[model samples]
Structures are given as structure tokens and as C-alpha cells.
Target: MTQTPPTVAEAIRDAALRLAETSDTARLDAEVLMAHARGVTRSELLLRHMRDPAPKGFAALVARRAASEPVAYITGTQEFFGLPFAVGPGVLIPRGDSETLVEAALAAAPQARRVLDCGTGSGALLLAVLANRPQAQGLGIDRSPAALAMAAANARALGLDARAAMRLADWHAPGWSAGLGRFDLVLANPPYVEDAAELAPSVRAYEPAGALFSGPEGLDDYRVLVPQIAGLLEPGGTALVEIGHRQAGAVCAIGAAAGLSCVVHRDLGGRDRVVAFSVTNELAA
Candidate 1:
């Protein structure tokens, strides 16, 4: 006899079990992937659709997750600062930790009329800031055409295109920041993962390596950025840089050497996640 197909709830339970070996948040992964497959929000699925028949191709999604693909990549979207951004293969998925950078920027320069975001994957940082500071005009630069395209598209989708623009430029390239002029605020969440640091299979295999790994100590990009920050900022402008929790001391040192003082900010988890910089004083973090 043919077995009955699983209901949405049953399918999620089984998918969670199948994914448990590969994912720490397997149940959450299953629910999110299923909600996407069903074209509903996870909350909607939980509140109203659990007993409904599973959507077609849910098993396929589960299989992808079972192989360790990121849920955001499969859904082609991720939320940052309450804004939905399109993300996939070449784009770095926006993380919550980076929100700390946004909050710090907003608090530091609420009237920032000009903003710049380096390595602005998907335009989440620049655009999210513009979304809040409506008077701000923002520019996001990236070396990858794919990332620039995604950032541009996200800007348009969010109706921030008028104020947010994407450019193809590498911060590490000589004279990369030229013609960009100065901004009232600058943001960067550059690659900070040490070359030898261990990462999950999903990240190593799928995420863009250019956006994840820095040199030996993961200070490569910071070395480039912190020095130029003073020039990028309008005299009193502020620069907010995201850092790996452990890199605060080292990153603050880099800022100090550049004659820029730093103020460290902690994420909800109380880990150092962002540092505010200005050329006025010694490192304070």
C-alpha cells in the first residue's frame, strides 16, 4: 500500500530529524525552509498552516539543507536591520552582528548627510542606514560585479535607489577611494576571518571566500581601511567598522596607529562587534 504524504507539521519534524546531524538549529532551518517553499512567513506557517499539506518540493529544499546549504541562500533573501535584501551565491549573507555597526553609526551621526559603505554586499549596510536617515545619500562599493549587481537591485527594491548607488571598486586597489571624496559617515564589514580559522562546511563551500577570509591574522582589510578612514571622513565624520569579537584589541591598535581613536560597541551577546573611529584622539576601546 502507498504511504500517505506527510502534513506540513509532520514534514517539518522529519526534515528537522534528517538535518539534526548537519545543523545546530535544524528545527529552525526546517521551519524556515518550509515557510519559503510554501510562500509564507515562518510565523504564518506556525500559526496557521502546520496542519496543511506540505508544499511541493519541500523535500528538495530539505535535501539541500541536509547537504549544508544556507537557508538564506536557498530562500534568496535575508533580513538586515528589518529590511529584506536579495542575497545568493556571490553575495555575502547579511548577519545580525553587523547590525551593531548600523546602530553605532546611527547613534554616532544621526544627521549624516553622506554615507559610504565599503564591500557593501547586497547594499544592506548603506541602504539600511539610508532607510532610517532619509536625508542621507549613500554609495556602496564592491570589487565583484555580482555583489554590486545584487546591491544595486536591493537598493531599487527597497525604494532607496534614489539615494543609494552601487559602484564596482575594490578598497584594496591602489587609489580605490579616490574621487569618492569625503563622507559624513563610513561603514565597513570587511573580511575578518583568519585564513586558518575553522568554519562550517556551509560557509567554506558556498559563501564567497573573498568576503570571508583575510590574511593570517585577519587584519589585512583593517590595515587598508583604518589608515584611510581619516581621509574618507568629513573632519568631524565618524567611521564604524565591524570586527570579529576577538579582533577588538588588534583592530583598535590599527586605528591608533592611524591616529584615529576607537570606541568599541557590543552586540546583544555582549561581544565586541563594531568600533567607532575618528582622527581626533587615541584609541579608547
Candidate 2:
């Protein structure tokens, strides 16, 4: 006799148990994957938990999650600044920590007419700001064409394409900002992970290495980009760049050396997450 298939509730429970061995948020991951597999939302899955059986191919998605792939990568979607962004293997998935950079920018330059985003993977930073500040136009620059294409696609999807322009340029390359013109606000979430620092399997094994790891101390990208920011900003303009938790002092020094005053902003976790710099002595409150 054939056996009955497991219910959606049973499938999620089993997947969550398997994922719990490797992930801190296993149950949530299971629910998200299960919902995606069923072409429904997590709430819908909950309502159908005991009524519906697991969909075909649901187990494969669970296995991928069990292997440590990011949920955003598997689902091809990540929410940043309350907006949805497409994410894939070639791009750095947007994280909540980076939202600090967005908040700081908006608060500091609410009327910013021109903005620039370096390392614009998925265009999360630039697009989020543009979404909030409707009068703003922005340029997003990245080295990877694949990442730039993704960012451009996101701009179109969000109806911000007319105001957003994406280009292929490496921030580390000298004069990469040429002809970009000065902006009222500049933002970046560059690669700041130390080369030797231990990363979770989901980050190390799946995310793009170039987007995560910098040099030995992880300050290499800052060393290259901080100095150029002052030239990129308009008078009284602000540049907010995301830094590693331990990078506040080092990044602040870099900005100071460039003759720009710097202030650090902490994320919700009270960790140093963003360094705001300006040519003027005062930054926005």
C-alpha cells in the first residue's frame, strides 16, 4: 500500500528541525521556504498547515536551505527599508544593518536632490533613499555588470527608473567617479569583512566573496573610498558609509585625514554601523 504524503505542517516541522542544526532562525526559514514552494505567503501557509500536503519540490528547497544557502537568495527577494529587492548569487543580499545607512542619509539630507551610491548591489541604499525622498535623483555605481543589471532592474520594477541611473565602475579604481558630478548625498556599503575573520556558512559559502571580504584588516575598501568621498560631495553634502562593527575609530581617522569631519552612528544593536562625514564641521541632527 502507498503511504500518505506528509502535511504542510509536518514538512515544515521536519525542515525546521533539520535547519535548526545549522541556522539560528530555523523555523522562520522553514516557513518562508515552505510558503515559497507553495506559491503562497507565510500566513497562507499557516492557515493551510494541517490541511494541505507539502508541494512537489518543496523538499529540494528545504535541502538547499539545509545546505546553508541564504533564504533571500533562495527566494530571490530581500526586504530593505520596507521595500522588496531582487537578490541572487552575484549580488550581496541587503541586510537590516545596512538600513542604518539609509536612515542616516534621509535624516541628514532630506532635500538631497542628487545622490550617489557606491557598490550599489541590488541598489538597496540608493533606491531606498529615492523612494522616500521623491524629489531626488540618484546614480548607482558598481564593478560587476551582473550586479548593475540587477540594480537597474530593481529601479524599473519600483518605478524609479526615470530617476535612477546605474553604471559599471569600480570604487577602488582611481577616477572612477569622474564625470559623475558632485552629489548632495553619497552612500556606500562596501566590502569590510576582514580576510581572516570567520563568517557564517551561509555568508562565506554562498555570498560573493568580493562583496564581503576586504584586505587583511577589512579596512582596505575604506582606505580607497573615504578620501574620494569629499570630492564627490557638494558643499555641505554628507557621505554615510557602512563600516564593520570594529571599524569606527579607523574609518573616522581616515575621514579626518581627508579633512572631512566624521561622526559615527550605531545600529539598533548599539554596534557601530555607519560613519557619516561632511566637509562642514556640523552634520545634520
Candidate 3:
């Protein structure tokens, strides 16, 4: 027997009301959940209410939202820089603020021919850049094979498979830059949260720790990665890295010590979230 769906207005109101108790993203989450339930886009849902009964399966998802699971994770996808990206448990969800990193990268090398995205999570930055520059080629590297697989899948979905490839590599390891030619640009959003203890409950408890923490100070990855990979950047090449809001000073200091001049960039909220740098000296193998 088929079940009858609640009215569209009723579903939205209920979801918003329930999610409001635990989530900061109440209205948006409600709209997304109801849209998913009716098998329609949010826009489509707004245009037409569900004509059938809500399935038990749909109600369960609503419960999941009430439990404080991120709507993006529940939906298994998110939009980054206007493109859809698949996201799940192991990989970090693409975030709007991270797009500020992408903007800085694109602004630095609008015509860059070859780029590298280190620790490419859901491949959000790499995919977003490729979408804007169809002629460019990129390589996305991640230490976790699971993250690499997610990145590769996103590449295929975004039709960037031909232009972008994913690989498993730790940016801090020795001889990691040997095979690839020097790149015109590097984009990375490495873990920069200094106080993991202070991260939101959802982040500290739900997100992968590997993708969120970088030692006690949060500068371990940059200290080891920037110097080794600076040789991988061609002269005149640029690197755009996302940094912790409070760690910009340390990030710039590290970049300068590594023979690069770093500049900080801010997100919409005016918090410093990205650092851009350029190699200042020629390097030998």
C-alpha cells in the first residue's frame, strides 16, 4: 500500500521547525530535505507540492536532519562555486568559504596551463577551476586513497576527467614532486584549524580528523609541504592556500622563509581565509 505525502507547505514547515532545534541551517535544510523527499529540485518543489504520501524512508531522512547531521552529508552532495560535488562521510564537504581560495587561485593565474591541487578532498577546488578554464590541465593529489577516489569520481561527474586526474600522494613526503613537471599554479586548502578543541561540534565529531587537523599548531602540513613543493612551482607560478582565520601571520612567515612572498586574502565575512604566494627565487633539483 502506498502512503500519502504531507502537503508541501506542511513538510517544509515541519522540517524547518524540527531542524531549528539543533541546526543553525534550519530553513535551508528544510527546503533541501523536502525537495529530496518529493524527488524534485528545490525550485521545482516550490512550484509544486508533493501530490503523494511521504514514504517512511523520507521521514527517516527528516529524522536524520533533526539529529544534527549536516544537510550536505545527508544529501550526499553539495554545490561549490556553482557546480555539484559528491560528498560523504570520509571526505570533507565542499564549503562556500573555501571557494574564496579558488577565487584567489583563478585570479592569480587566469590563463595557467598546468595546475596542481594538493589534498584535493572532494576535488572541489580542482573541479571548480577546470570548469572555468576548459583548456587547463590539473592534477589533484591526496594522501588518503578514499579521498582520491572521491575526487576522481567528482572529476568524471564534472566532465573534467579528460583534463584533470587524481592521485594518492602525501605532499610532505620525500621526492614527491619528482615525476610531475613544474606547475604554473598550486591550489590547496590543507587542514588549518589551530584549535581543534574549538571546532563546532559537528566538525570535531563528524568530519574526518585527518581532513581537519594538522598537528597541535595546525602549521605542520605547511611547514613540511611548502618548502618541498616550492621546487615544483615554475618561476612566476603562484600558489593559493587557504589558512586558518587566526593563522595568517604564521602562514605568511612560513611562506617567506620558504622563499616565497605571501599575501593574505579575505572571505566575504572579512576574515582572512586564503594566502597567496609566489616563488621568489629559482630552484634546482
Candidate 4:
């Protein structure tokens, strides 16, 4: 006699147990993956848990998760600032920590009509800001064409394509900012992980390295980008860039050297996550 397949509830429970060995949020990960495999929402999965059986590929997804793959990468999507963004191997998955940069941007330049995102990974920062400020137009620059393609695809998915543009530009290259024009706001979440820093296995193994590691000190990109802020910003323009929790003082110093006033913003966890800068004090005045 053939054996009966496991119910959705059973599958999720087993998956969660297996994932617990590697994931901190095993149950949450199981629920999310199960919901995705069933082509339903988490709520729907909960309602149908005992009634339906696991989908065909549910076990495969669980195995992938058990191996420490990020649930967002496994699901190919991540939610940020109340928006869903497409994510995959080449792009950095959007994290809640980065939302601090988005919030800082909107609060610092509420009237900004033009914005720029320098290392636009998934276009999360630029797109989130544009979504909130419907009157704003924004541009995202990245050295990786794959990342740019992902960002552009996200712009189209969110219906912000007309107002958001992605381009190929490397921050370290001379004149990388040329022809981009001045913007009322600038945002960047440049690579800031120190080369030798220890990272979670999931992050170090799956996320794109070029998007994570800056240099031996992890401030190399900030050194190049912060100084260029003055040249990219309008007279009273503002910039909000994400930094490692310990990078506040060093990054602020770099901004100060460029004649930009810098202020650090902490994330919900009370870690310094964003450094807001302005070319002039007029905005404060």
C-alpha cells in the first residue's frame, strides 16, 4: 500500500525542526517557504495547514533552507518599507537595518524632487523613497549590470519605472558622477564590511561579496563616496548613507573633510546605521 503524504502542518513542523539547527527563525522560515510553495500567503497557509498536503517542491525548499540559505533568497523576494522587492544571487537582499537610510532620506529632504542612490543594490532605497514621494524622480547607479538589471526590474514591478532610472557607474572610477546632474538628495549603502570581519554563514556564503566587503578596513568606499557628496548635491541638498554600526565617527570625519555637516542616525536597535550629511547648513537654517 502507498503511504499518505504529510499534511501542511506536519511538513512545516518537520521543516522548522530541521531548519532550527541552522536558522534562528526556523518556524518563520518554514511558514514563509511553505506559503510560497503553495502559492498562497502565510495566513492562507495557516488556515489550510491541516487540510492540505505539502506541495511537490516544499521539501526541496526546506532542504535549501536547512543548508542556511536566506529565506528571502530562497523565496526570491524580500519586503522593505512596506514594499516587496525582487532579490536573487547577484543582488543584496534588502534588510530592515537599511530602512533607516530610507527614513532618514525622506525626513531630511521632504521636498526633494530629485534623488540619487549610488550603490543601488535592489533599488530598495531609491524606489522606496520615490514610492512615498510621488512627485520625486530618482536615479540608481551600480557597477554591476546584473544588479542594475535587478533594480530596473524592481522599478517596473513597483510601477516606478517612469520615475526611477538605473545606470552603470562605479563609485571608485574618476568622474563616475559626471553627467548625472545635481540632486536634492543622495543615498548610498556602499560596501562597508571589513575584509576579515566574521559574518553569519548565510550572509558570507550567499550574498554578493562586492556588495558587502569594502576593503581591509571596510571604510574604503565611504572614503571615496563621502567626499564626492558635495559635488553631487545641490546647494542645500542632503545625503543619507548606511554605515556599519561602528563607522559613525570615521564616516562623519570624512564628510566633514569635504565641508559637509554630518549627523548620525541610529536604527531601531540603537545602532548607528545611517550618516546624514548636507553640503550647507541652509537646510537647518
Candidate 5:
């Protein structure tokens, strides 16, 4: 005799338990994956399909998650600043804490018309800012072609392609910003994780290392990029750079040394998450 298939709720319940060993948000992950498999939003899954039969191939998705794959990667999408962005293996997944950087940038330069996003991975930062501040046009530079591809795709998907451009460039490259005109605002979420820092299995095993670790103390990127930021910004332009929670002092010092004044912005958790910078005489509020 054939066995009955699990209900959507039952499948998620079992998958959540299995994912618990590997993920902090196991239930949420299960629900998200279930929604993906069913081709519905999580809200739709809960409201309209909880009692529905388990989606075909959902067990495979759960298995992947239980083995530690990121839910965003599994679903090929991640949300940033209330916008959906296309993301995959080679691109860095946008983080919620990084939204603080977006908020700080807009707060400092509400009418910014020209924006630059250094190390734009999925174009989420530049695009989100431009989406909210409609007058702005943005240029996103990244060294990785794969990342640039995703950024470009995200731009097109969000109907910001005409206002957002993705370029292949590196922060460390000499004369990289020569043709790139000064911008009214700049944003960066550089790799600031220490080389030896411990990370969860999912991050260490799946995320791209080139986008995760900066140096022994994770100050290498800031050292090279802050001065560049100083050159990129217009006279009164502001920049918001994301930082690891404990990195406020170090990152702020780097900004200061580059002749840009700094202010620390804390995430909702009250952790130092972004450092806003501006030319010394024109510090961002």
C-alpha cells in the first residue's frame, strides 16, 4: 500500500527540527524553503497552504538546508532594505545589519543625486538607496564578474537598471576612480571579517572567502578604501560604511586618518554596525 504524504505543516515541522542542528532560525528557514518549493510567499504558505500536501521535491530542499546551505542561496534570493535581490553562490548575501548603512546614507544625504557603491555585491545597497531616493543615479563597482552579473540582474529586476550601472573594478586598483565622477553619496560594505575569526559552518563553507575576510585584524580593506572614499565624495557628500560590531573605534580612526570625520551608527541591536564619513569640514549628521 502507498503511504500518505505529509501536510505542508508536517513537512516544515520535521524539516525545522532537522535544520535546528545547523541553523539558528531553523523554523523560519523551513518555512521559507517550503514557500520556495510551493512557489508561494511565506505568508501565502501560512494563510493558504498550511494544510496542503507537501510540495514535490521539498524534502530535497530541506535536506540541503539541514546540511547547512544558506536559505537565501537555496532560494536564489535575499531581501535587503525591503527590496528583493537576486543572489547566488559567488555573490555575498546582503545582511540586515547592513541596512543600517543604507539608512545612514539616506539620512545624511537625503537629496543625493549621484551615488557610488564600492564593493557592490548584489547591487542591493545602491539600488535600495536609489529606489527610495528617486532622484539619485548610482554606480556600483565590484571586482567579481559573477557578483556584477547578479548586481546587474537585480538592477533590471527592480526597474532601476536605467539608473544603476554595475562596473567591474577593484577598490585596490590604482586610478580606479579616475573616470568615475565624484558622487553626492557613497556606500560601502567591505569585507571586514578577521582572517582567523570563527564563523558558522554555513558561512565558512558556502560564502565566498574573497568577500568575507579582509585581513588578520580585518582593517586591511578600510585602510585601502577610506582614502578612496575621501576622493570619491563631493565636497559635502556623505559615505556610510558598514563595520563589524566591535570595529567602530578602528574603522572610525581609519576614516579620521583619511581626513573624513566619522559618526558611529548602531544597529537595532545597539551594536556598532556602520560608520558614516564625510570631508572633515562637512561631517555627516
Candidate 6:
């Protein structure tokens, strides 16, 4: 005899319980995965859970979670800076901490006519900044073609493609920085996780390591990025960067060494997460 499938309520509860056992995301992971499989929102799924059965696909999603895949990877999208962007294995998932970087960018870019986002990832920062500055045009640069494609899709989805462009160029690649030219604003949330060996299992085991750590101290990206940015920004232009909480002091010094007057910005958690700076000489002029 065939067994009966569980109702949506039963499935969600079971998934939540199982996910809670293996991941810190817990109930949220369960809800997001179930909603993705059912082609519904988390709230919509919960509202009808009592009346609905777990779709077959949703059961499979639960199985995947049991094996430890990130729910955002399963859902193919994530919300960041009040916007939804496409995401999956190749692209780094957007994180709320990065919003501090976006907010800093917007505040500094109020009068920006041209902006640039380095290491665009899923294009989260670039798109979020463009949404706030209708008069500003922006370019997003990434080393990965796949990442650029996702960024472009996000821009088009938000009806901001006319003002945003994407390109594939490694920040460390020779001649890459020179070709991009000057901008009134620059933003980057480069990898700054200092202790890769001590990362949470959910992160070290699942998220892309290349997107999480840079150099031994996790300060290599900043070291390479700040000096290049100094020459790239137009006079008086600002740059916003996301850095690790503990490494804010070192990151700021690197920016200062590169000629930027830096100020570290803290996240809602009161941890230093972003740093904003501009060329001191220009401001002094």
C-alpha cells in the first residue's frame, strides 16, 4: 500500500524541527525552502498550512536541507537592502550586515553622478545604491561572468538597467583597474573574514570560501583595493567598504595609508561593519 503525503503544516513543522537540529537558520530555513517549493511566500504558506498538503517538491527540498544545503541556495533568491536578488551556488548569498555598506554608500553618494561597485557579487550594493539615487548611473564589476549575469538580471528586474552596467574584471587583474576609469563613488564589500578556521559550520561548510576569506589576516583585499580606489575616484569622491568587526582598526589604517580619510560605520549590532572614506587632499583643497 502507498503511504499518504503529509499536509503543509506537518511538513513545515517537521522541516523546521529537522533544520533546527542541523543549522542555526532553524525555522526560517524550513519556511523559506517550503515556500520556494510551493511557489509561495513564507507568510502565505503559513496562513494556509492547516489546509494545505506538502507538495512533493517541498518534501524533496526538506531532504536536501537534511543534507545541509543553504535554503537561499534552494530558493534561488534572497532579499538584501530592501530588494530581492537572484542567488545560487556560484553567487555569494547576500547578508544583512552588508546593508550597512549600502547605507553608507547612499549617504555619501547623494550628489553622485557616477558610481562603481567592485566585487559586485550578486550586485546587491550597486543595485541598492542605484535605487536610492535616481540621478546616478553606476557600473558593477566582478571577476565572474556568472556573477555579472546575475547582477544584470537584477538591474533589469528592478527597471534600472538603463542606468546600470556590469563587467567582468578581477580587481587584482593587471590593467583591470585602469580600464574602469574614474567615478564619483565606489563601494565594495570584499572578503574580510579573518579566521576561516573558526567560521561557523553553516558558513565554512556551505558558503563559498573564496567569498568569505582574503589573505591570512583577511585584510588582503583591503590592502589591494584602497590604493587602487584612490586613483579611481574623482576628486572629493567617496568610497564605502564592508570590513570585519574586529579588523576595523587595521582596515582603516590601510585606507589611510592609501590617502583616504576613513571612518568606520557600525551595524545595528553595534559592530564595525562598514568603513567610509574619501581622499583627504581633495577635501583639503
TM-scores of all candidate predictions against the true structure: 0.97, 0.96, 0.93, 0.97, 0.97, 0.94
Q: List the residue pairs that clash in candidate 3.
A: 4-53, 4-54, 5-52, 5-53, 5-54
Compared with the true structure, what per-residue lDDT tens digits does model 1 show for residues 190-249? Answer: 999999999999999999999999999999999987898998988788999999999999
Superposed on all Cα atoms, the candidates' RMSDs to the truth, in angstroms, are: 2.2, 2.2, 2.4, 1.8, 1.9, 1.8
lDDT (C-alpha, whole model) for all candidates: 0.93, 0.93, 0.84, 0.92, 0.91, 0.84
Cα displacement (angstroms), candidate 5, residue 231, comes to 1.1
Q: What is the lDDT of candidate 2?
A: 0.93
Candidate 2: the clashing residue pairs are none
lDDT of 6 by residue, 1-285 (tens): 998888777887888888777777777787888788788888888787646777888778877877777777878889998899988777889999889988888777789999999989888999999999999999999888888999999999999999999988887877897667789999988888775459766567778777788977999888888878778889888889888889889988987777789888999999999888788974436
User: Cα RMSD (Å) between model 1 and the true structure?
Assistant: 2.2
Candidate 5 per-residue lDDT over residues 126-221, each given as its tens digit = 999999999999999999999999999999999999999999999898888889989999999999999999998889999999999999999899
Among all windows of 10 consecutive residues in model 5, the one with the lowest summed lDDT is: 276-285
Off by over 4 Å in 6: 1-3, 282-285
TM-score for predicted model 2 compared with the true structure: 0.96
Q: Ten consecutive residues with minimal summed lDDT in candidate 6?
A: 194-203
Instruction: Write the number of the candidate with greater lDDT, choosing between 1 and 6.
Output: 1
RMSD, model 3, all Cα superposed? 2.4
Lowest summed lDDT across 10 adjacent residues in model 4 is found at 276-285
